[model samples]
Target chain A: MPEQTDRTENPEHTLVEVRGFRMAYGATTVIDRLDFEVVRGETFGLLGSNGSGKTTTLRALLGLIVPTAGELTIGGEPYRPGRVRVGYLPEERGLYKREPVLEVMTYFGRLKGMTAGDADRWSRSWLERMGLADKARLALGKLSGGQQQKVQLGVTIMDDPELLILDEPTKGFDPVNQRLLMDIIAEQQRRGTTLVLVSHDMAQVERLADRVLLLKDGVARAYGSVADVRGEFGGKSLNEVFLEVYGTVGLEEDAA
Target chain B: MSAFGIVLRFEVARALRKKAFWIGALALPVIIGVIGLVQFLGAQSAQQAAEEQAKAGFEFVYLDASGVVDARLATELGGAPAADADSAIAQVRSGETEAFFDFPADPSTQPVTIAGRHVGVIDDGRYGAVATTLLAESAKTEIGSPELVAIVAGGVRTDVTTYLPDGSVSTAAQSLPVGILLLALLFLTVVLLGQQVLIVTTEEKENRVAEILLTTTRPNAVIAAKLVALAIAGVVQMLVVFVPVAIGWALFGGGLSIAGLDLSQVVFDPQQILLGVLILLGAAALFIVTLAAVGASAPSAKEAGGFSALSIILPLAPLYAAAIIVTQPSLPIVRVLTYFPFTAGTTSLLRNAFGTLPLVEGLLVAAILFVSAALVLRIAVRAFRRGALEYDRMLGWRDLLGRPAR
Candidate 1:
């Protein structure tokens, strides 16, 4: 089935296409006329400040939330809830506190359509890779938060998802775990997975992203390769460029 | 190996690791045993104490207005003869005598009457037997038939025997404890299992786990796995409590006695048991699905609690209607509850246990519950997927009617 579908399509090219997308909650618009494309095997970054709708646009691409008005497609097909080949790591960190690590990972793998034995085998290898082989029998809550995050990441990639959407993947991790996460992301890209990384960290975004879209006030302020966007800001850092595009005065100014 | 099996395994493992699950599962049965032991010991001691108190000779008086010539009457009334009627009456009036027997002159007109201030204060089984004999004799005299007199007199000498054709008397005793235990076991299981659905949904909403899960898997699969998992955990807990108690009763001679109980008439046959179990599964499924859906609809766990409480409390209505259901299982209220997904599980189980359900009706009830469970599950999954992915958004009736989520 994979070969037949692959032969019939341009698998070496664009994997996700979002054209003239607009999303709104009532009168408050989050993404307006957004246009972008994610080529196969690239680690793309959706760079934005808080409430800049980075999460919103990524969600749209995965068909998690429908765009108020837009066209989004995945794998040369219209995005549907079950048909879309995407794995997502949401902004909030979540794990069933009582579930053993191996069991939790395998359960997620099976849900993504793998057989139980396959899921189990993949989970075992993933755990070994993350240095969690010995802790496979331990409940998720018994592990350290960083260890749990590794398990969550394993659940996402275990299915060999065609597209991966990770929101703030390194939000609560220390530098070491962050490095581990980056490695996993790099590995996924090498395996031809299209990644949409939503992050506020400028250094990580700059270092890893093939292309960057700076979203501000529900509009794309900058959309191009990371180098091109950075060059447009006259050698400014991604963080400085983000602040310039989306005014950072409201929250802190109100507090002061 | 199958999708369902994998989902089931994950759920069971997750629930088993929760500390609250173990505590709730084992506590009630132990408490029940301890309470039963205490009550039994207390009853035995009370009986022994009463026997000791009976050693003191009990005073008696006779109000024989008929002036009968038989001297054996007074002796039969008490172990020792009374000194005089006047003195005996004084003792009776002052409450010294345990009882006073009054035989009117025209015994043919009035039956014998026994008056006592503290008749039931002690176990006076002996005195009760004597009174009954005297009343029968008086009744015989009123009949005035020589042949019947011989039969009545013969009946007095005969030992009375009681038999239960349905063997329900013994079955009732056994069923009482088993039924209570089953009810409690199921109740606790529902609460524990149902809480998992609520907690998982709430945590997902709070921590945004649903968003991640929704991306790769269908919402229906997630919701289905959750309900199945909780149900399996519930069944396991029930078995843990049920198997031990059932085994102990059977092997230890304290098991449910079917000796005198006519179990043939019991309504809950094997088919009914199956139907009831199916209904229970459906009810449980519906309850959890509704709760998860509502929880998903809510903005936070605290808000979810309010909605989940509605699902939790709805099943209890059937319990309150238990007495009525047993008497009239086909009553409109019972019929409706039996058909409704939420109440059908428990009510139908009880009805089957009591042997009240008819065959055709039971199937209909099961079908209704099953279909309802499926429908609710579908809606719940949709709600969960929509709620998780849509950030800070509320689902309304309009949204459900609108275009399906892509």
Candidate 2:
């Protein structure tokens, strides 16, 4: 295990931290000892190919999965929902498909600790903003795949959570909708929300991430600011750097 | 509202909103009511046909070789005296006589012969019934004492009150049906709610709503809320079913009896009813939590159904051995069932209702059920917490026991 320097050594600026984190299932270690921190008000790109322990890391950090032998904390304490305002967009996108779009959104909002009226109002406003104003009463299953993804994102950010963890938020989106989603994520970042964006799109990560962690085979292959990571890889683009690190096998896995 | 309340309210409201739930809830009562209505209408129609037949009048001739038949009685019953057997046979064969009755020399030992034009199979029973009535009337006239006639009529009813060793009146016969009724009710409720209980946790997993909810609330709280919500929904469903039945009972339950069980004679034992209720509550709680655990452990609702069926079968399994439970309540198998948490509800109810279960033993059974229910509930909650996020595979025993992943 290599010791990695924290960009911001001060605990107050670090909203998310993982120290010597390890996760295993039946002797199969999914994540080996790893270390990183997400500073307040910064977008941290957790970049990895498929099955590279990216989702597992996020799940562990959110306390959804128990860490085998290390510490994972948010806001200086282990994640306890409602203790800190947090939002998550899981890679496997789904909601109550039989339920009305607005109702599904509001149900999640209430679970996130928003008042019913506030949840309803926010959900309606979000539908309008996302150009899904006509879809409020329609069953979520009636929406197209891309539209459902937009609604899923709306649910994730509905409460204006202090921290947003998005896994493949722009997946299955057209270029224009992808741009709109990026803008919304950037807005959240500008509002001082610490964000962890997990994506395969190197350009999106390079444009949004202040610091990035490139993981391969459950180990951190590159860590620190995007510029420092690029420089570490001989000043190549993050895409070229990703190609160099994962090679053709990563591409094959990603395509699968 | 608290997260528990939110989850509970959402689950119950979701159930109430589904058309399938209401249809399922209303199905049993509707089918029962339809059956009852058909029976009632058929009875009325049969009765009306009989009254019309009586109004039209029946003409008959009698040849009494025994001389037991009184002339006045025969006249009152629309019977004419026939001079000889030949004349009576001729009249009946020519269709001039609707019917003819021949009383043998010894009417008590020898059968009365009825020669009549063919009536329908069921209607032919009226002839034999009327003949018996006529004989009884004539005998009453001959005896000249109402008491002797009453004794001869075979209308004696004996109410046997056996004393227990402690001199308490034995009400076992009276309580048998009541106990069976309670057991049946328990079986019915479990069957009605089994599928719903099973799907409560799996629905969240299948719909991918579990992770979102788990991120917001405590897992135990969510599981507990769902169990409570399922109970509430079950109660609601039963109410929908029973309300109409109660209304039906009020409207047309006159002369309604099951297997000759005069329900009116059933003694309402307050202590016994209370004990049965407590046992039921414990069993219901245990069943709900167990099924909920099964739901959480399974990856999908369909898979959970297989396990839920097994859980539903356990409580009702003792019913197959009901004869032993009732006849020999102290038998080892019966005692085991009475103490076992899953089977205890039905066994205890049966024993208590049959007046075979001692008060102390009944109370102990209730206590055992409650204690076991609590233990199972704790285990279920723990398993649910561990398995709630497992969407791709079933949770095995090792996972359920909370052991660290191998």
Candidate 3:
């Protein structure tokens, strides 16, 4: 396993640290001896294609999946749930479909240790900020796909989590809301919230990420700042760099 | 508040807000209340109809001429002796008395003469039954000694006691309905409570809510809170369904006595009641947790719905074997059903209620089920934890069997 380097420029310091992390299900190792760090107040992009163990890594980092062998710390301590103010939006977007939009948001907010009144107040403010205040009382199922995505994002960010992990948060949004959501996430990042953004959208990652780690087949394909990765792939954009990285693997596997 | 409390309160409030929950929770009690109302109304209507019929029909006027028989016979028949037979006949003619039972001239073996207006109201069969009752009294007074009358009128009172092969005796005076009640209460718990566990857990899977919840709270906490919530819901629904029925039963069925039988005489073994309660709790734990696991494994609520029916049916199948259980208590099939964790509650309850299961055997079965229930709950927690992020897919059989899925 490679060692993780610590950068000295950050004030909030390291929020997530993984050293020699290994994860497996029975015989299949989904993540194999990977190392990474998510510094405080920075957007860390975990970039990978489908089935590349991105979700598995985030799950391990959050303590949802136990590491087969390694040390992982969140907020400078062993990863104990509810010990830190953390929020997550899973890739498969879902809320209580029978619940109204605001209710669903507040329920999750309360689960993250917010009191009902505080949760309710924050949830409604978020709904208003996201241009969904009128639909607060409507059932989540009644909302359009894009609207539900917005509500899901609201749930993820409403509690002002110190660290927030969003998996495919912009999945069903339109171009306008997509940019709107990106701006909102950037604003949250400016407020000193450490964010781990896991997605296949290279353009979004390149625009938002301060540092990035690219994984292929659960092994790091590239690990550096965006400019370093762009320079490694001959000054191409992160999207072109991603294509260059995986495009060779497809051919090699085909030839084999 | 603690995360468990938050989760529990959230789950319960969400479930109660649904229209289906309210409908399902209220259906049984409403049905029972309607039935109780009908029963009470039917009884009152029948009594009133009988009184109206009696007002229009023939009522006997005793016309005794034998001085020795005059007072006692009339008192026994709920009437008084007439001053004059001629006056009674006159009264009958004027509709004051519908009929007359004229006494014999002497208190010999001769039959009394009955006179009445020839109408449909003067049916001989009705008057004859009255006459036979009165004559039997007269004969007893004339010939029967006090002890003979006691022996003839009130025969031997026997209380049944069954001596088992083990030489321990059982009292058979308790109503069999108590066991049936235990059976009902057990199923109602499963239906009202266990099924909600299924729906709630399945909704978590179907909606992908577990994906977020697992990160915020521990899996075991999620499972624990879910079970607690469903338990509260089950108790609430059971009370809603049963409280009214119980009130109605107490109000109307207090007089629901069998002839020559006393409710106070019925006694049951405390060990057997405890066994029934143990069986109920064990079955509840097993069924609710197992159903939650099944629901968690299902990919969608629609799929879970089918398994939900199976959940209900599996616990219910033993109830259909009741006829076999009654006469062939502890028959192999019944015994198997009684000892198995899922089927044990209602089966052992029925058996215990019937005094069919011996105390030792019942205790052993309850202990096994209680242990099994505890184990299943632990297994369910493991399942919920492992299956948390498996959205849009099922727990593969290989994975469920503790083998590598890939």
Candidate 4:
């Protein structure tokens, strides 16, 4: 199948673009000649197994790590601090556990340029909506893992960011809350928000992802719409496709 | 608000909310208050004892290897003499003797301390007065009154004046308070604010929140904000302690016959005051950024602690060395400490506050420290960005230097 259109060429509709991006730490190259674009209002899935450079790619784009060589842009501007309203929820649950949930939420909201009153008001509404109105006063450590995940979701969405990158947002949630959060994430994209979804749960991504990129050892193994990749990989389901991709990808890495 | 403002406000808010910060800030003053209370109680007890002593008079039990001073002391003060030093201590412990004056074993080198039973201000005043009279009589009879020795040992009164920077003369008592207050401020700022800088800087890594914070705000902004916030907190805390402590010290300090050498003259020198202020500001800048650099490269709060202790000790070492800096100001080690990054501010602040450091020399050291602070801040920001995620293993000096983490 032809590759899904990369919006980076247009630059107008692209919220994030990376062309010929290369990132290396000493002799170890985490990303080599990687190319991808996250366009405005698109739910783009970045799928890979552990150590497959999905997170590395995200980190490099966010300027957490300096890219060795690349032309990368956020909102058509070089990556400077606070250039756009970008929200990122890392995979490892990175909120301060000792801090109150509302506090972390309000701090992030203000960092995203909301006034104190607006941030507080919006955070309260999000907390109640996430069924965590009672837990707002408590520390994040007091909440169970699933409960903390919900509060983190409130933090990521409290400012109503224009672009979001969520890594496994449904990781510790039960099936009910998982579906609930998935719906909220989908609704966010429906309101003209762009998303870069990084998940190992291919079934979930297949449902929500408009387009998906499958990476193997820092290279794109498959890049197209979910349906197109499905057809290209013998019309298999995403679970079967993930297995087939990783099965061969492992061999490729071993060979390299 | 700017991202810098948000980070700084968050740091200050977090610090203020911490119970540990408040405890650390107020711990010194509470201890001082306890000591002052003890001192007040001691004064009361001594006053009661002094009245009893007037009726009883002084009894000296002594073991004077040198025969001259003790024989003269017994007749002059009319105290019973002891067989040996041990019995005299026993007598005092049992309230039989008022004091035991153990003269120096080597006279020229060893110290002679006066031990007293139920010692009070009256006893102290009488002991000095008596020791002087007997020593004077002995010198006139035995050594023909060495004129210089007689003059100083007689407690000859002086004008006790301090020449001001404004060409006005003031009492030595006034200079003591101002100089001591500044020295105390310098010490607390370095230790307290340095700790705050480490705690705030390392906490982000411990919480693993740097990943999110870095994306939203620059690393430099995050570091700058934490430093500024802690500085504000430090200044506020310093004032909170200063105003009350100074008031108490000033109000109750006069007419108390304390044994220690007077500090009213330590910072009384005109040139030292100006030099000390420069060093104090410079040292503050140096300590903040250097500690931030240490915190950034440390893998966890536990790892950061050793570095914090080092930071605390280096600045404070100069204060501990004040005796050497004051009397022997030209020592090579003292000069080296004044220019060293860690010791510079403290040595300059303390030495100058004690009137040892010259103005031109102290300013040059201050400029070096200021430049070092800026340079270290740049290093810290870079280290923070690179090492934020390498939490599983330690990041050390090499990691801070341009060597990327594997």
Question: Of the candidates shown, which would achieve the greatest DockQ relative to the real structure?
Answer: 4
* Model 3 per-residue lDDT tens digits across residues B1-406: 8888888888788877888778988987787779989988999986675444433444667765664453565565555566688887788789887678877757467677776666555344456556555666776786659778877777657756777678977564364555556678888887677656767777777787787878777777788888888887777777878777677667866555545555445455566667777777777777887788777777765666776777678788876887887678747898788777777777777777877777788788878877987777766676676676676676655545563211
Off-target runs (Cα >4 Å) in candidate 2 are: A1-3, A131-138, A174-177, A248-256, B39-165, B168-181, B245-266, B404-406
RMSD in order of candidates = 8.0, 5.3, 9.4, 6.7
Off by over 4 Å in 3: A1-12, A24-29, A251-256, B30-171, B257-272, B305-310, B328-334, B358-360, B396-406
Clashes of each: 11, 2, 0, 1
**Candidate order (lDDT):** 2, 3, 4, 1
RMSD (Cα, Å) of candidate 1? Answer: 8.0
What DockQ, on C-alphas, does every prediction get?
0.44, 0.38, 0.33, 0.51
Model 2 agreement with the true structure over B1-406: per-residue lDDT tens digits: 9888888887788778778889888888888889989998999988776655544457888888887788897788788987887888889899998788888989889999988777888677666665666776787888998877777877677878888889899777776666666666677678777888777778777877666777777787788888888888888988897777677767766555676567656676777777777877888888778887788889898987887787888988987998999899888999899898889888888888778888888889888877887777776776666666787898887777775321
TM-score of chain B of each: 0.64, 0.74, 0.64, 0.69
Q: What tens-digit string does per-residue lDDT give for candidate 1 at B206-248?
A: 7556766666555666667777777777777777777886676
Tens digits of per-residue lDDT for model 4, B303-369 = 8888678877888887678788767878998888878888887667666555566668877997898
Error of 1 at A37 (Å): 0.8
1 or 4, greater by lDDT: 4
- Which ranges of candidate 4 are over 4 A from the true structure? A1-9, A135-140, A174-176, A249-256, B39-156, B160-177, B249-271, B319-321, B396-398, B403-406
Candidate 4 displacement at residue A74 in angstroms: 2.5
Tell me the tens digit of each residue's lDDT in model 3 across A64-165. 777787877887676666789887888876888988888888888888888899999998888888788999999999998788878887777777889989
Output the lDDT of residue A125, model 3. 88
Give the Å error, residue A198, model 2.
Answer: 1.4
Local distance difference test values of all predictions, in order: 0.71, 0.82, 0.76, 0.76
